[model samples]
Target: MVAVSQNKSIDGRLVAIGCNYEPWIALLEQSGWKTHCCYDLRTADSILEEYSPCICVVDLSNNDFSLNSISLRANKTKQVKWIAIIKKEQLKTDAIRQFINNFCVDYFTVPIPGSHLLDTIGHQLGMLDIEASSWVEITSQHDMGLFGESKSIKQLRDMVRRVAMTEVNVFLTGENGTGKELIAKSIHNLSKRKNAPFVLVNCSSLARDDEKLSLLDGTYRNEEGAPFDGTLMLDNVEELSKELQDNLLAYLQAPSCESLDEEMASDVRIVATSSADLDAAVANGDFSKELYYRLNVFHIKVPTLRERGSDIFLLAETFLTKFAREYSTMASTFSEDSKQLLLRYSWPGNVRELINQVKRAALLAEGNEVKAEHFDLPSKANLKQSLRNIKDEAEKDVLVAVLETHRGQVASAAKDLGVSRATMYRLLNKHNIVPDVRHYNNGYARE
Candidate 1:
């Protein structure tokens, strides 16, 4: 009976802000979310007061005003699930970004296939039900900084936590600069292996012949009494020569000679990264099949920046703060135009691109606010054939208009754009617009 009741409770109510009977709602309703729509604060509050919905969906289309009010209510109520629905281009805006960081529980962006969205939402609902089951009263904590609230990232994080508690091998797969190495370090930090040496080797940097031999033959402990129990991260393992692949596998298979006297045995937990498709490589007879299978024991795939939904700005701000501190730049906020641009960009280089841009902008910025002119993005002509072209232009136009409207509070600009705070920074980057540069707490721009 208890199991029956528990299983039935997965169905949840959804309070939608800024929507008007979209086909998706009908689909959601079919899947068990009792969907209700609201276009304004009054209607939203009334629905909240009446149905006590467990989830709230904020529609970004025609809904800038609702963002401010909904965030306030979500903070006050503290129990409702708030999800943001937005286009991929909107991620470049400051307002949308800011709103998500402060209030959103999750997000679904454009190009999100219907099946994927449904699966993600279903997973979120299931997780919420589990959280609600505990007897110990605890507040749920949500971190919106990583640009993803999807099931994939959630599942990956859960796996990271579980794997971190153990001593084993972890292999991460992602596009170049998708932060595979960062995730590896995160796992290392969270593990009992934190105190041990964390060695990183870039397999791609080594020549094919050099990579084939035991590169570490004399680097560390050729003699005895050397330390072990460290973390070894083989970066870009897809680049390993066939000979090297076989050599490493042979070492891994031999626990006797490889062991550093059993007691001081190689307690090294292996973490490997690959931007290329190792499976395909092995299937194509380019890489050793056995090596690929060995590394597949545990895996994590970091999503690209464009797929992270509204967390784009969160990551931008993180880079902004780090760059500002390092460069002593006065850029305090992103212009509305700048915010939109950030969301519009399809970051091919992922977080690394954002970081590089932020660093460059900080050093070259003329005022407290970084302006669109500060960034040296590709020319509109060059971007014409790019996938993000349309998104980029729309972001520029909207941000230019928003900045004209708000003068620049970052907060105000974001509010006008109907996005979260973190999103605003992305807009700035997208359009290459900078914000007013002001000395921290000094309240004044230099010139």
Candidate 2:
């Protein structure tokens, strides 16, 4: 294997341990990287202390490469760019896959292409260069509105990518304010018909059955007189009037309408979103079963914010970064206590609610860090917090946590909170968190 020197001298050095050096070394040397290699990691600690590698290549597939030892090393030197090489079958385990994602820059499975490996390594190195140059400047801009890196979110992203590759109709199902419209727009942005119209019409907003049908029919013929052939997002599909539903069924079943030309008929992609459980609604006679089945052809269920608990922090941090800039606030993070409170609370409104709260806290924060008091959680109600009222502050925290747990169900929250129902009612009135009588069921607020 030939050895090539890097253009910029790597001060921290590069280390490869227990890797199949014959193949990767040839590629690395060809790519002009001179790395220090070692088969034994027993003296890795001393070697790391001496060399302090900026990059570490650990081939976990090798029997000699101890996963436990590598994990320890990774924890000690978290800054290093660790690249793991393994067999494809090893990735089948969720734990191993997650561990790699959490710790490594990337992974290369068996049957590796030498050129692809070089390209990936080069790309990762380039990213490091970019990151070190001006991290704040590089990361500050925020137009990519999607958030979350949880396993569920990763799966959702993969699903979105797959759906975006096609021209088929997509049915997005989730609770209200779960960003169903955002998902639709994402699909449109990624599709071949991106340049065309991305129309959105809330089925619930239509005044009458005719109005619902006319909404699509009107859009079919654009203002420029060109047939609108893009993405059509029918929001709140469950709320579509019965006649409108029948018309939609007819369109999906037979896109070749006599009034439509060849180009207009084939170009449009339909995406429908519903906050309500349409399948359950259909079974309960609240929605048409035929329409429900038609829409369910390609379905995606967006998880609620609470369901993705770990993602809350990422979303909160993202919101804070934006709000800090917009509000000209110096608050860069939530206080430790505030962070615990945020994680403990259940987000009924999903991502939308998190954004609202983060923006509010950022604006209201008196210092560089957002404090628990800045949350203004509904349970705080009207309880006046005087400088001497430590008990009130503690009570407010406890009460707010309980209310959020019950989704604003005062009596249930009070019961969990270990207070009498009467006291809970009084507290709710004082805090302005009175449970909505219309939607209360199973000790939780439906909305």
Model 2, 21-115: lDDT tens per residue? 56767777765676555456655566555553356666766556557667877766623567787888898877568769767878888766778
Which tens-of-lDDT digit does each residue in 83-107 have in candidate 1?
Answer: 7778888889898888887667678
Predictions in order: lDDT:
0.66, 0.69
Model 2: weakest 10-residue lDDT segment is 135-144
Candidate 2's displacement at residue 430, Å, is: 26
Clashing pairs in 2: 381-431
Give me the overall lDDT of model 1. 0.66
